[model samples]
Every structure is written in structure tokens, then in C-alpha cells.
Target: MLYRTLGGTGIEVSAYCLGTMMFGSVGNPDHAESVRVIHAALDAGINFVDTADMYSAGESETIVGKALKGRRDDVVLATKVHFPMGEGPNRGGNSRRWIVKEVEESLRRLGTDWIDLYQVHRPDHTTDIEETLSALTDLVRAGKVRAFGCSTFPAEEIVESHVVAERRGLGRFRTEQPPYSILARGIERAVLPTCRRYGMGVLTWSPLASGFLTGKYRKGGAIDLTSGR
Candidate 1:
């Protein structure tokens, strides 16, 4: 497991982050088996785990939180917000109110006091990027989160947020997570380049094209991932 520093944060994470998107009802619901996978990944030198609150309506985080019990110090834990956890309009967005409330919920579900990297699941176009950064900066100051970032953000938004951080003296985003796979190479055209330019660590999703490169399915073959477990 090759570890790379997360930009200027002085934190090292494994190249292959264990993604818990398939945990809970969407995949395996057995807590024992889910925990085993996490344990095996850790044993196999996976020091990073990425999950999101929207995954299976936060069930993934619950499983991951239980899996990391008694060994939280050994891994760099990350999770995302900014997605609807409920039907209400106020349930999601990068607003300071939601961010503050959501992180606390995330931490509770993860069984951890602080998240290593708290990420915005998506750009909340309805809210100001400056407001998001400012809220995240406060979380860092309060020690509720160590570092923060964004996922699936456009190149322009990433640059704009950085400028806002600089101008407001807020905590800058230390990482940028995007969708990068053989099939989806769009990030390479702009987003990846901007992250490199800004010295932000890039952690991408869909590296296997949703198992397309795994060779488990034939070309033009249909896969039923409905029963993910």
C-alpha cells in the first residue's frame, strides 16, 4: 500500500482507499461480514476508508463506524455530506447549518470524535462556496474535523472555493475527489489538472468503471447488481 501525502496537510493515505459505498442494505447487511471486510482491508494495508452519508441512507456509515471500533487510530477516516438524508429541502446542501448538523451526525454514526477528512459530497450551487468553506473552517478550528474537501466538483468551482478561502482566511480544501475511470476520463481534461495545479490531493472514484475493467462480465453483458451482496 503506497501512501501519499494529502497535499500540504502532512497526512499520508493509501493509494487505494476502501470505499464503503456498497456496505449495509445496498450490499452486505450482516454487520459481522461488513466488519470483516473492513478488517481485512486494514490488514491488507488499507489506511484510508471513504464513505458517504447518502449511501444506503447512512447505513454504510453505521457499518463502517462499527467496523472501526477500537482501531480508529490506525486509519484515516473520511465521509461526505451535502446530500439529502431526508425528504425535506433543508436536509441537504453546503450551508453552514447543515454542515454543522451533518458532521455531528456523521461522527456519531462513525463512532469517532473527529473525521480525518470531511468532504462535501457535491457542490451546492444554491449556497455560496464561501459559506461552505467558512463553516468547514470552523469545524477544523473546533477539532470536529481534521481536514475537509469536495467530491465531484467542477474545475471552476474548485478554483473559486480556493480563492474564497484565500480571501477570507478560511481553511482551504486540501483534496479533490472526482470520478476517474477508463470510461469516464473527463476529469483528466480539466478537474485533475486544476487539482494538480492547486497542490490538492486527488482521490477519484469509479477507477474500475463500476467493475467494467474487472473482466467478470463479458463485453455488452448485462449485470444485475441489485443484489450487491
Candidate 2:
């Protein structure tokens, strides 16, 4: 796998980051099998791993944590927050209260003292971007997270967040994770160029278009739900 520096941060990561969204009950449901797959990817030279606290309600992080027991230093670990973790309304969003607690939980589950990249899973329309940046800045200063970023944000929101970070003197998000594939080209219109202009590293997801590129989903044949029916 080719490695590239994420934006100007100087941290090199594999071009194909091993995504662990499928490691937990949401996908594999088997802890041992998930660990084996993670190890296999690591053995194949995949030095980046991306996961989220909300994946399988946090089971994915637990699985990835165990997988990285002796090898956390070798891989660039990235994870996201700002997703609903429970029934309470406060359990979600990018507010300072949630961001502080969520990141700690994420670190606990990953069994690491610091995350290479800590990201807001998505933009919260309700919370002020300044609030989110402020909380993230604290995390970076405290060494809980090396860098901060976001995922699935609209171009305008991305720009706005940068502006807010600058105005408030907070550490800015250095990367953007947008869903990209041959079929979904919407981000190409603005998000990609915007991130490029801001010097933000862009890590795309669903490169296979949620299994559309695998040629498994036919018009009339039997369908497999496990592979995205």
C-alpha cells in the first residue's frame, strides 16, 4: 500500500485504510474473526485503521482495541464521535459535554492513551462549530488526540468550521472523510476541491459503493443480505 502524508501533519498513512465498521455485531458479530481480519490487514501492510464509537454501538472499537494490543504504535489509528450512543438526546451531537465524554470513551475502548486522528463523525447542525472545535482543541493540548478531523461534512460546513476554528484560535481539523466511489460523485463537485484548497487530507469511504462494484447484486438472482442486500 502506498503511504501518503495526511495534509501537512507529517503523519504517513496507508492509501487503503482498514475500516473496522464491520468488525462488530453490525457486520461480523464474531470478535475472534474480526481480530483475525484486522491482523491480516496489518500483515498485508495496511497501517491505517478507521472506526467509530457508534459502530455496532461501540463493539467495533472494543474489537479493534484488542487487535491493537501489541501493535498500536505501528498503525495510524483513527476514530470518530458525534453519533447517537443511546436513547438520551444528549448522547449525540457535537456539544462540548458530549465531545469530552465521547472521546474518553473512545480512547478507553481502543485501549490507547492517544488517538492518531480523532474525528467528529458528522456535522451537528444544532451545535455550534466553535463549540466542537474548542473541545477538540483541549483534547489535542492534553495529548488525548494527536490531531482532529471530521467525516461526511458538506463543503460549506467544512469551510464554516475552519473559519470558526480560526476565529476562536482552536486547533483545526486536518482531514475530511467523505464517502466517495465511481457512482457517488457528489463530493467531487465541491467537497474534494474545498478540502484540497484548505490542505485537508481527504480519506474516502465506500470505495466499492456499498458492494455495488462487487457484481454480486443482480436483477433476479438470490440476494445476500450480509453483503449489502
Candidate 3:
């Protein structure tokens, strides 16, 4: 696999990242098989792995932890927060309280001391971006996370985050995870350009349009709803 530099961070990652969202009970329930697939991807020169805490309620992270037991340092491990992990009032979102607590939980599940790339899973309109950045800045300073980023944010939100980070002198997100595929090119108009302007790496998800490009889903026929695709 080809490697590319993520924005200006100097960290090299595989152009072909192995996503682990379907590794747990959400998609594949076989633990051994999941580990084998992860190892296979690693062997095939995939150095980037992305996951989230909400994936199968954190089971995906646990499975990834088990798979990366001895070769953890060889991969660029990334994961996200800001999703509902429980039924509590303060269980999720970009609030400092939830971020702080969820990071620990994610670390425990991933069995890692520091995440290579920690990301906010989505935009949290309720919490100020400053609050999220401040908490993330503390994490960077404390060595809990190497770098951080955001996902599924609008162009304006991305710009606002950059401006706030500059004014506040906090650690800024180095990457953006957007949904980009053959069918979804809306980000190209503004979000991609903004990310380029701010020197943020772009890690897109559902590049196959949730399996729409696989020829399995027709215009008026059977569609694969598995994995929420």
C-alpha cells in the first residue's frame, strides 16, 4: 500500500486504511475471524486503522486491542468519541466531561496508553468547540493522545474550529473524516477546500457509498441494509 503524510503532521499512514467498525457484534461476531482479518490487513501493508467507541458499544475497540497485541506500534491507530455510549444524560457528546471520561474508556478498550489519532466522531452543536478543543489540548499536553481531529463537520464548523484554536492557543485538530464516495461528493465543493486551506488531513469513510458501488443495490431492487449501509 502507498503511504501519505497526514496534513502537515509528518505522520505517515497507509493510503488504504482498514476500518474496524464492523469487527464486533455489529457485523461480524466471530472474534477469531475478526483478529485474523485485522492481521491480514496489517500484513498487507495497511498501517492505518480507524474505529469508534460506539461501534458495537465499544466491542470493536476491544477486538482491535486483541488483534494489535504485539504490533501496536507499527500501525497508526485512530478512534472516535462523541457518540452515545450509554443511557445516561452525560454519556456522550463533545462536552469536556464526556470527552475526558470517554477517552479513558476508549483507552481501556483499545488497551493503549495513547491514541495515534483521537477524533470527535461528529459535530456537537450543544457544546462549544472551544470546550472540546480545550479538553483535547489538555490530553495532548498530558500525553494521552498524540493528535486529534473531527468527523462529519460542516465547512463553517471546520473553519470556526481552526479560528478558535488559533485564538485560544490550543491544540487543533489535524484531520477531518468526512463521508466521501462516488455518490457523495458534496464535501468537494467546500469542506475539502477548507481542509486544504487549514492543512487538515482528509480521511473519508463509506467510500463505496455504503455498498452502493458494489453492484449489490439496484435503483429499485434489493439493497443491503447490513452494517447500516
RMSD of each: 1.5, 1.3, 1.2
Clashing pairs in model 3?
none
Candidate 2 at 229: error in angstroms? 8.4
- Assess candidate 3 and give its lDDT: 0.93
Q: Summarize candidate 3's per-residue lDDT along 58-148 as a digit string, tens digits.
A: 9999999999999999989999999899898999999999999999999999999999899999999999999999999999899999999
lDDT of 1 at 25: 81
Off by over 4 Å in 2: 224-229
Models ranked on lDDT = 3, 2, 1
The CA lDDT at 113 in model 1 is 95
Task: Give candidate 2's TM-score.
Answer: 0.96
Model 1 lDDT tens row, 1-229: 7999987799899988999998888777787898999999999999999999998889999999998989999999999999898888899999999999999999999999999999998999899998999999999999999999999999999999999998999999999889888889999889988998889999988788777677767868787876332
lDDT at 136, model 3: 95
Best by lDDT: 3
lDDT of each: 0.91, 0.92, 0.93
The clash count of every prediction, one per candidate, is 0, 0, 0
| Candidate 2 displacement at residue 153 in angstroms | 0.7
| Model 1, position 22: C-alpha lDDT score | 86
Kindly give the stretch of ten consecutive residues in candidate 1 with the minimal lDDT sum: 220-229
**Candidate 3 error regions (>4 Å):** 218-221, 224-229
